[model samples]
Target: MPIELPFDDEEASTDVDLKTQIIRFILTGAGSAVLDFGLTMLLQYGVGVSGGIAKACGFVLGTTVAYLINRRWTFRAEPSTARFIAVVALYAVTFGVNVGLYSWLSHLWSETVIYSALAFVVAQGVATVINFVVQRAVIFKIR
Candidate 1:
């Protein structure tokens, strides 16, 4: 028997098709990542904030932007208190993963912009995959 993938299903639960949704999600993620990374660098290097705290601050702001755009555009979802709660819960999980990974990975190398950026990218990449999967299959799935 062949294993089925969510994106392969023709009867999608979202307003947008899975392929289109993935594309939009990637685009949205790119923009969000820029905001997240830039803010993290500024706070950590420019303003002398601690690494984990800076990462947490950036993740919050970036993910907020992502949720707003994704609801209106990517998933075509309307605002709902239940959905909002779900998203916040989901973000909270990813927040720990993203920030924790960044903190751990950054310590693996000497403090420098290049090393920090690589660490950020690694952590962000892991969190991004988790975000897309959960948002598509659970939170934003049309009921």
Candidate 2:
């Protein structure tokens, strides 16, 4: 009693392992987060940038590494410019959440960079959920 769609045959042919995908995603994401956090600290404290600016810049830098590796290596999708564009659009949407939450939380906590980073973590957590779903379905068309 299952509905057969246009992609049922295609989906059946692939037979991808969902658990492997999840594990790869987590491992790759951990590497990307280290890049983000390390860069954020360097930009903010080492270079005198503001908390919001540092996190924003880090988000861009980190996501660049993420998209390239995730698309090419992790998911092993056929590269598409349209999918890259979708990623940038999603990043733009998440950018607001990242900066806004970081600034708001930092203000409440006496402007600690640690607080800002924690806030960025929360914001990126939200973005991560959206990114994984979209990447698997729309970007990679993975089953």
Candidate 3:
């Protein structure tokens, strides 16, 4: 299903302002983040997955959502096989960073729910910045 945001580019596919693109990207990321956090928590506490494993699973869902929304709404890029593969490669790199940091932080903290969530947040924040910069400048640049 397509999500129509304020800056959606159904008519135009290029010449978007940077600030506008950033706003749309953030909105897309926010929606993805909700899914990520919810799934992470559910898997961690409810399904008894380890914190790192839960976060890895959640990251996959979250980034996949982000890619769909960002391609259509934020960057307004037409789908391409090459672009998709590049994005998958980028996500693979970020996944390692996110999961590694999450695992390291989880080990430092007590196994309480709050600590787990906090660690996830920190790891997610780092990965978010990296994802945005790389996606905007390299993966989905105006072209």
Candidate 4:
């Protein structure tokens, strides 16, 4: 006798390796960070927004990019309000974590630009890990 899947076998590959998925998310996020930092600087320099305000604007932009990428490309989640809310809540948690650490670590580096870059890396890195956990356990879990 042969085993039968509950769903049709025509579905996309379900065995995407966890490690690969995380790496893909990171790479996508890295691309998004460029937009984040670039927009932050443009707002700060050209528009003269304060650091905190500029960071907030950039974060929103970057997070939008991340959400679209993660949902459509990385996780390929089915559309649902509960899943969307979970992603937002998870990001909100990571947002505070990212901002706090970025502010603290920005002081560690000499050049402000360099400091900002490193802060983005560190904060985004932490957020990425948290996203993986949340996405795997809650957000993207098939139920």
TM-scores of the candidates in the order shown? 0.88, 0.80, 0.89, 0.78
Model 4 superposed RMSD (Cα): 7.3
Q: How many backbone clashes does candidate 2 have?
A: 0
TM-score for model 2? 0.80
Residue-level lDDT for 5 in candidate 1: 28
Question: How well is each residue in 75-104 modelled by candidate 3, as lDDT tens digits?
Answer: 787776777888989999999999999899
Q: Candidate 4 on 3-52: residue-level lDDT in tens?
A: 22233334433356778678868887888888888887787666887656
Measured by lDDT, the strongest candidate is 1
- lDDT head-to-head 2 vs 4, winner: 4
Query: Model 1, stretches more than 4 Å misplaced?
Result: 1-13
Clashes of each: 0, 0, 0, 0
Per-residue alpha-carbon lDDT of candidate 1 for residues 1-143, written as tens digits (9 for 90 to 100): 32222323234335689898899899989999999999999999999998989999999999988988787678876566788889989999999999999999889888788999999999999999999999989998644
Q: For model 2, how does the per-residue alpha-carbon lDDT over 5-118 read when each residue is reduced to its tens digit?
A: 232223232234677667767777778888888888898888989988888888888788787766655665555667667878877876787667776777778666676667
lDDT of 2: 0.71
Rank by lDDT, highest first.
1, 3, 4, 2
